[model samples]
Target chain A: LAKTTQPISMDSYEGQEVNITCSHNNIATNDYITWYQQFPSQGPRFIIQGYKTKVTNEVASLFIPADRKSSTLSLPRVSLSDTAVYYCLVGVPFSSGSARQLTFGSGTQLTVLP
Target chain B: DAGVTQSPTHLIKTRGQQVTLRCSPKSGHDTVSWYQQALGQGPQFIFQYYEEEERQRGNFPDRFSGHQFPNYSSELNVNALLLGDSALYLCASSGGTSGSSEQYFGPGTRLTVT
Candidate 1:
């Protein structure tokens, strides 16, 4: 399992683009960088995932460099609803028995101000 | 289709007692994973179940056991609960046993221990 470190908290204004960067220096060869959004009292929701380069979806975009040591999650046009904690995870998807668990770090708390 | 569903949205238990949390996976998902999230912190992986067997586990103790039924539903059982066990229990479901399958999480069960 790879350990990830991210900002503890961030503040952004509504309608702005928010980028949260996560560092995983020990990422494995088969590991994938995944980002999740979590609201209070609710479970974490998958935002985007990327192995290398970049991946985009309706909700967010994930950019990974060639080194795969770090990745950034970009949320466009942030709203008050986008104020939540974001988690960055690096892991292999259950290909092996030991790689099945999803390890979450302290996560980055993004507060979208009005 | 219905996403992951957890029962007893909230539970209250006393120390030294036992409690169980249930979860039904997504429509076509075959794997279920459990996690514990403390207040103001990120989630901690407990274990994952696939094909009605425990495929992987985290640093949780033996007291934190789980069972996956034939229908792909799961139950998390904790015995001799301590005050620290009070947190939100999350259940996530994914499609298969390989690849980077995205996981869907439930609303989570808030367990309060006194």
Candidate 2:
């Protein structure tokens, strides 16, 4: 299983861009890095995913360096709704070896203030 | 179409009791996965069911079991619940190995074991 490490907590202001980094040194060769945001009593919602380089979506951008050892989730112009726990997960393509069995480490709790 | 749905939004059980949580997968999804989320920690994968069979399981004990129905609905059953079992139980649905790997999660059922 691939292990991930991330900051336990982060503080950001409302209108500022927040970049949260996660490190997964033992990631598999076919693994893709995925991020999820979870509010208090709700299931995690998908944010962004990328294998390498940068993938931009309407919600966030995923930046994975060439090394593939680390990735960053950048949320632009964050609002109070962005305050939640962010989880970084690594997995193979659907139905491949260990595809849906994701191991989530303690994610980074980001608190956006006014 | 409806997204993934979980029943019993909140449950309170005593030690040594048993509890069952249910989930209904999103439309066109055939895979169901279970997770346990403790307070202040990330969600932990418990198991995945595809085609009404246990395809993959996490490091949890045998006390944690699940079943998937032909309609793509799933159930998580826990026997002899302990105080440590107090956490949010999450259910996720996906298109299985044949389709995209993007999994959609439900609102989750909060389980409090006292």
Candidate 3:
């Protein structure tokens, strides 16, 4: 399993764009970068996932470089409801014979100010 | 379709006691994983169950065990609880046998050990 390091906290204003970056210096080739957002008292929600280059979705965008050592999660037009802890995980996806466990770091706390 | 459902949204236990938390996977999901999340920290994987068997486990002690049923529902059992064991327990489910599938998390069960 690869360990991830991300910012402890970040601040953004409403309607502003937020980009949280994660560094996994020892990421494996079979590992994929996935991001999750967790609000207080709720489970972590999947944001975006990518192996390399970029992947976009309705909620967020994931950017990975050629080296695959780092990835970024981009959230557009932040709002108060978007305030949460964002986790960056690197792991093999779950499969029939492969029971890969998702390792979550302390995560970056993003607070959206009014 | 229901994403994931957990029973007893909250629980309170005493030291040396036993407790069981239940979870029902999302429709069509066959894999269920458990996690422990402490306050101000990210979730840590406990174990994953598929095919009614334990497939993978984290660094947790043997006191932490789990079981999966034929319907894909699961139960997490903890015996001889400790104060440090008090945290939010999360259940996630994923479908298919492909590596592209992502796990969906439930609301989580808050457990307090005194």
Q: Number of the top candidate by lDDT? A: 3
* TM-score for predicted model 1 compared with the true structure: 0.95
lDDT of 1 by residue, B1-114 (tens): 788999889999999999999999888778899999999989999999888889888889999999999999999999999999999999998865434478889999999999
Per-prediction DockQ, in order?
Answer: 0.61, 0.62, 0.71
TM-score for every candidate vs. truth? 0.95, 0.95, 0.97
Question: Could you tell me the lDDT of residue B11 within candidate 2?
Answer: 95
- Report the C-alpha lDDT of model 2 over A7-67, residue by residue, as the tens digit: 9999999999999999999988999999999898899998888999999999999999999
True contacts kept of 2: 0.60
- Candidate 3: lDDT of A38? 95
lDDT of 3 by residue, A1-114 (tens): 899999999999999999999999999988899999999999998888889999999999999999999999999999999999999999876665478888999999999999
Identify the runs in model 1 with alpha carbons over 4 angstroms from their true place.
Answer: A94-99, B97-100
- The clash count of every prediction, one per candidate, is 0, 0, 0
Put down candidate 2 lDDT per residue, B7-112, tens digits, no spaces. Answer: 9999999999999999998888888999999988888889999888999888899999999898989999999999999999999888743376778899999999
Task: Show the colliding residue pairs in model 3.
Answer: none
* lDDT string, candidate 1, A7-107, tens digits: 99999999999999999999999999989999999999988888999899888888999999999999999999999999999997543233378889999
RMSD of each: 1.8, 1.7, 1.3
Clashing pairs in 1: none
Candidate 1's DockQ is 0.61
Whole-model Cα lDDT of every candidate shown, in order: 0.91, 0.90, 0.92
lDDT of 3 by residue, B20-86 (tens): 9999988888899999999999999999999999998999999999999999999999999999999
